[model samples]
Target: MWLYAGRRIVLTIPILLGVTIICFALVQIAPGDPIQNLLSPTATAQDAARLRAAYGLDQPLMVQYFIWLGKVCVGNLGMSISDNVPVAGEVLHAFVNTIVIALISVVLAFVVSMIFGVIAAYRTGSLADRLITAVAVFGISVPPFWLGVILVIFFAVDLSWLPATGMGASGSETFSYFRWADFKFAIMPIIALALPPLGIMTRTTRSSIAEILNQDFIQTLRAKGLSEAQVIVHAVVNIMPQAVAMLGLQLGYLIGGSVLVETVFTWPGTGYLLNKAVLTRDIPLLQGTILVLATAFVLINLVVDLAQSLIDPRLKRS
Candidate 1:
């Protein structure tokens, strides 16, 4: 198991470097001059040249990439063009906000899916099963951005039960946990991010569990005079590794989907931050944010792989 984990860890180094290269390349080739943001309308040609030279924009692209890469290797992410602050610190702060929102969304999705999925499996073909299937289908089919808009219109506009936007009370800079207001602000975004994954997980879990029940082991256990509940408990335990694996994929979806959900709800997270960076064409900041997000997504899947190996020894062979 440790060997497998070590192998996975080693493999991730190249993948991360590849991601970094692609991120750097995309930013370099993007059409607009990043230095434009620094110039005033009244600035002279020398001012433009000076700013370009200062940023090393006059150098070869590969040289700039290697310089940036060197800084990244030494725990420096450089500075943001938008605010002139440390890019690493800003990205880390944004990551914290994103994790809080995304993790909660993931948990909610997992719980909701497992419960409904299990019920649908147990009730197979009943009215409850049909209703669950319908709702799960609807949840999966609806786009998060559209759903978020509808929810904002209904709850925030018409009902006024929840705030339409923002991470917390007005003018708040950081989120404080355990505060009802903060959680209150997150509710809609959470729901928007959670629904599609919840639906997919529910469908998959139901199908997987149902398939597991048909296996010879399940029949043997039943023949041994185990109660239905006992048989189900056994099935659930056997299915946990599958669930863990599926959760990892769903987590990736949550992170990707956050860009849309955060934008619709104006939640102050990395996704929102990325949107701002793009609009402002802040290349240094954009590269840093994407790199951090990609790293997080990769690390999460690594944990999932390790967890699956721990839960099911058979996976270690693969």
Candidate 2:
């Protein structure tokens, strides 16, 4: 197990390097000059040149990339052009906000999807199964950003049951999930983020469980006088690897794809930060945010791979 884990970790090095290249390349290819965005309308040509040189934007692409990469290696993500602050600090702050809600959303989706999927699988052609399938389909079909808007309209605007946007009056720094005031702000975004994953995982889980039930091993277990619940426990354990993989993929999706949902809700997260950076053409901020998010997605897959190997040692051989 340790050997397999070591190999996986070693393999991740190249993937991380590739991620950095993609992050840097994407930011560079994006239209508009960060220096132009930074300067005032009346700023002179020399002012533009000086500012560009200062940010090393005047450097050759390869040279700029190396400089940026070198700085990143030492935890310096450079300065945000629009905000005029350290990109690392800004990205870190937004990342924390994003991860907090993302983790909660994924966990909620995982648990609920598992329960719903198992029940639907067991019930098969029954009305309960149909109902659960309908819900899952709805979740899968709906876009999170649109759902977020509807939720905000219904729950926040009409019912006034929850706040529509922002982290809270106190902001992310003092935010606490345990506090209703702050928690209410998260409800819609979490729901928006959770639904698609919940649907996807539900389908995956139901199919996995159903397949396991049809296997000869399941029949053998049943013939051995195992209770239905115990048989289900065995089946669930057998499908855990697939479930973990799906969960990780869903989490990566939520982390990277929440831009729309965050924009709709005006939630203060990396998605929101990315949106702002793009609009302002803040290359440093954009690069830092993408790098962080991409790294997170890669790391999530690594952890998920490790988890699967642990659950099914046969995976290690593969």
Candidate 3:
């Protein structure tokens, strides 16, 4: 297990390097000059040149990338052009806000989908299975952003059961999930983020579990006089690695893809930060946010691989 883990860790080094290259390249390819947007309309050519040189924008792409890479290695993400602040600090602050709700959404989806999947798989052609399948299909088909809007209208505007947007009265710093006042603000965003993943995972789990149940080992277990529940436990264990992979993927999506949901609800997360950065063409902020999110996605997959290896030692042999 340790040897497999070491190999996986070593493998991530190149992937991380590639991720950095992609992040840097994507930001460079994006249209518009951030410095032009930053400067006043009446600013002279020398002013623009001086500002560009100051930010190292005047340097060659290769030189700029190396400089940025060096700073990143030491935890400096450079300065945000729009905010005039350290990119690391801004990204870190927003990342914390995003991760909190994202974790909650993924865990909620995992537990609920596990139950739904198992039931649907066990029942196969029954009405219960059909109903669950229908719900899962709806989840998969619906756009989270659209759902977020509907939820905001129904719950926040019409019923007034919850606040439509923002983290809470006090913002992310003072917000507590334990407090109803703050928790209510998260419900809609969580629902929006959770639904798509719940659907995908439910389908994956149902198919995997159903396949496991049909295998000869399951029949052997049943022939040995094992109860239905015990047989199900075995099947669930057999499908866990796949379920965990889906869970990790969903979590990564929630962390990085919540821009629309976050925007709808005005949640101060990395997604919202990304949206703002893009609109303003805040190059440093955009680059930093993308790098952080990409790194997060890669790391999530690494953790998922390690978890799969632990659950099914056969994975290590591969």
| Best candidate according to lDDT | 3
lDDT of 1 by residue, 1-318 (tens): 789999999998998899889888988778998787779989898999998888778889889989988998887887889899998988888788788778888888888888888889988999988999998999899999999999999999999999999876643465665777777788898888888988898998899888888899999999999999999988888888989888888887677558888899887678888998999988888999888888888888889989988998799999
Candidates 1 and 3: which is better by lDDT?
3
Q: Which stretches of candidate 3 lie over 4 Å from their true place?
A: none
Query: For residues 1-318, what per-residue lDDT tens digits would candidate 3 score against the true structure?
Result: 899999999999999989989999999998888889978999999999999899899889999999999999899999998989999999999998899899999999999999999999999999989999998999999999999999999999899998999988878888899999889999999999999988998888899999998899999999999999999999999999998999999999999899999999999899999999999999999999999999999999999999999999788888
Score candidate 3 by TM-score against the native: 0.98
Off by over 4 Å in 1: 170-174
Sorted on lDDT, best first, the list reads 3, 2, 1
Better of 1 and 2 by TM-score: 2
Instruction: Show the lowest summed lDDT stretch of 10 residues, model 2.
Output: 30-39
Candidate 1 lDDT trough over 10 residues, lowest sum? 168-177
Best by TM-score: 3
Q: Per-residue alpha-carbon lDDT of model 2 for 150-248, expressed as tens digits?
A: 999999999999999998898888999999988999999999999999999999999999999999999999999999999999999999999999999
Tell me how far candidate 2 lies from the true structure as C-alpha RMSD in angstroms.
1.1
Candidate 1 root-mean-square deviation in Å? 1.7
TM-score of each: 0.94, 0.98, 0.98
